[model samples]
Target: MDDHRIFAESLAAALAAEPDVDVSAAGSGPAALRCLERAAGEGRRYDVLLVDADLGGHASGSRPAVPVQDGDEEGLVDGISLVAGVRAAQPAVRIVVLAEKDDARRAALALQAGASGWVAKDCSLSRLLTVIRGVLRDETHLPPALLTGVLRELTAARRHRTESERLVESLTPREREVLRCMVAGLGRKAVAERLFLSPHTVRTHMQNVLGKLGVHSTLAAVALARRAGVGPADLTGDVVERGSQLA
Candidate 1:
């Protein structure tokens, strides 16, 4: 699963040099899926798949190069996105993603999507082979450089989510209604109309929401609200808040 045919095929040739490794290259996400499907149908399943993290770009290749369109299962465009699809085709397959740059964010996504590991595209051949073999033994592998980053990335995301939920929970019932309106892209005046409140009252509620969310703008408020799983105006339920509701 890479768009660069030379890189894909060259890597494939190198891996095939191993006496026990049977490897082939696919230049696009679709092509990879096809290979998996065909192999499964023939009852000759592959044991491993190495994919490029950044696929579907402006790269020339002899193999079929397909752009990562806003297509393919909820806009799956890159090797990280292709992880789930690969698992669907061959549940037993071990996937190791290759990235030109090491990214903890992308690595977290790959792991969550069922990839066994991720590695640098420029990693040494020996390390690459070691990772491939490691996954076969059901070991989750990552380069030492990415271990701390991925751990911190995941931890920070979790902490932020908890804080956001707590902040959203702190809002009064009326304040929650205002925050939901913000998420719907509603202006204070529009929110007033929808909620049957005076514009002055809407402004006050909006200010309170901003203050509670620790943000200075409506866009920031909406972003935090989304992180807290706040739905649109129509989807929000009027809930009663205790102690902090100076309503």
Candidate 2:
């Protein structure tokens, strides 16, 4: 039997061990595509596509994790990309990426690109089988370590973007001027003098800017302004390093 057939047999055997599962396997992206196409044509559909990250490629000699490639730009086929391609070809099928521990980033990318779930290949056979079944049932199964990291990064990026937009929308011309001066490390009195306004007016504008930004102080306002993409040239000096603790 060919490698495809062997892989299919192994997968079949694994599924057979689980009495509740009834899985059919396809060896390659093209074969999987055809399977889905035929199923759709006949008004049928498979539950999921479990894709191995390194398919039809040799492992790198130096780094076991890497794949050997023929060219630089047109690199070797990655399993996550294959999942994306399968989803593109068969919009009706759910895709699950089977990747190694080091491929967590790639797996995360796959999820962002529309894969339903990611399972680490090194997981126990029972866990792997269970995750596959879960994916088939349209559920996401991620190891706790990987899931936490992915959630943290995604949340941080989202908050950064949101705060940036709000800060821009809330800034008035005079307040923006005061912010620029404050960011330059100037004291309240100096900022008022530079803008030719009363100290009380400067303090009032600073309070409004802070309240609108939902930040505690002028230093935090400056930091939020910078994160919101306000250029340093537009402002005066370096922003205070108030750690990014979202209120």
Candidate 3:
């Protein structure tokens, strides 16, 4: 036994019913890490690590600590980070993220961060057990709805990366600069001002970029630019654009 009393209890109960498996529990990320470290130190290792995404550390005075906001430099240890840490420490261990019903975004991030699979907490205990066993066997155990979303995002990201590389290869240096501005949602006049070109020249480049991208409108051009990895930082100068399109 290590720490997650609730999940550990449930898993223990399930494994008890099975009679062929041994299950252990940990309450916090640090405890889980410690358990793994000790097991490794003792030349023992578990088959898998199932991490809950919302273990908000220890509750102090009846309320749990709020999670750190996105991009926080302190690097808060949510479930995803916990699993990443575990993987870093024990690369051979399989990891499964236990997410909430609406955790599609977090689940996608987890997969990108190297989690083997994701299971929603709302699923049945039997389903959870099955997923746990499946992940232990080096198999994917994603729920159907979550699997669909993950696959869609993965495909979209791949397409965007591929299209961006092609655009970079096809465009001239100046055209690439204009496309970067467009990706930042800048208009013709704004792009011209940033590049020290006339508005007419900017418009001409925009049209050429659009034709090269096979897009029909400024909006479509911007969408294609984002897929090419053109962000505000890629802009020629500090031109603040409105209504940026993100992929």
Candidate 4:
């Protein structure tokens, strides 16, 4: 959804022109929510939602938008909250943030709120379509400019390794081994074979890894591990170092 009806409708129309594409538009977050609710009641699910990051401004063909403050989850005036709301209602649905500016902070907030991807307003229509399709395939489409900033922010939040080290300490020896394999780009079956464990055991360890890292995806967990200096080469030594504590 966007605050400007003309932009939203124009974009929706352009998308609708594509074969096998069904597109809709909303002028505000509330309208979008209402639309989602109605669709849910009708047993119709949306494949993806495109929401503008700064939706608190005036909406075209609708009432003045509600003002949303930063970090307000209940307020539907902004994309972050809308993303969270949509995620809460439909865990499997993919949401993409549409931003007029490359504001890293806003992009970070939207992603943290469960947005699967983001698109800059200045991007071409083809690019937006590609992002939507990529998100549908479960690929995160973070802009390179935003991704560098997001990674920096993520790494900067913990200058010292104390917190990350503590999180790593929480993992079992088996889980640490699984994470090490993950950092090396091993699939679950590969990790299982390498670790001499059942595939089911490997899956369980992967779940534990995600839990300890407080991330949803293995890619995210691996990134956190690399940032925390827990690369594959260090995995064996790190496990030994944490052995006494785990015991």
User: lDDT winner among the candidates?
Assistant: 1
* Clashes by residue pair, model 1: none
Q: Summarize candidate 2's per-residue lDDT along 197-218 as a digit string, tens digits.
A: 6789778888887887888987
Worst 10 residues of 1 by lDDT: 68-77
Displacement of residue 190 (Cα, Å) in model 1 is: 25
lDDT of 3 by residue, 50-115 (tens): 666675344421111111111111111125566666677666666677665646667776776667
Deviation in Å, model 2, residue 132 alpha carbon: 3.0
Write out the backbone clash pairs for model 2. Answer: 183-237, 184-236, 184-237
Q: Which pairs clash inside model 4?
A: none
lDDT of each model, Cα atoms only? Answer: 0.71, 0.59, 0.62, 0.67
Model 3 residue 29 CA deviation (Å) reads 0.5
Q: What CA root-mean-square deviation does each model show from the true structure?
A: 8.1, 14.7, 10.9, 14.1
TM-score for each model: 0.58, 0.49, 0.53, 0.55
Regions of candidate 4 where Cα sits further than 4 Å from its true position: 1-3, 57-78, 157-247
lDDT over C-alpha atoms for residue 59 of model 4: 45
By TM-score, the best candidate is 1
- Where is model 1 more than 4 Å wrong at Cα? 1-3, 56-78, 160-247
Better of 2 and 3 by TM-score: 3
TM-score of 4: 0.55
Write the number of the candidate with greater lDDT, choosing between 1 and 2. Answer: 1
After the best TM-score superposition of candidate 1, give how far the Cα of residue 216 lies from its true spot, in angstroms.
16
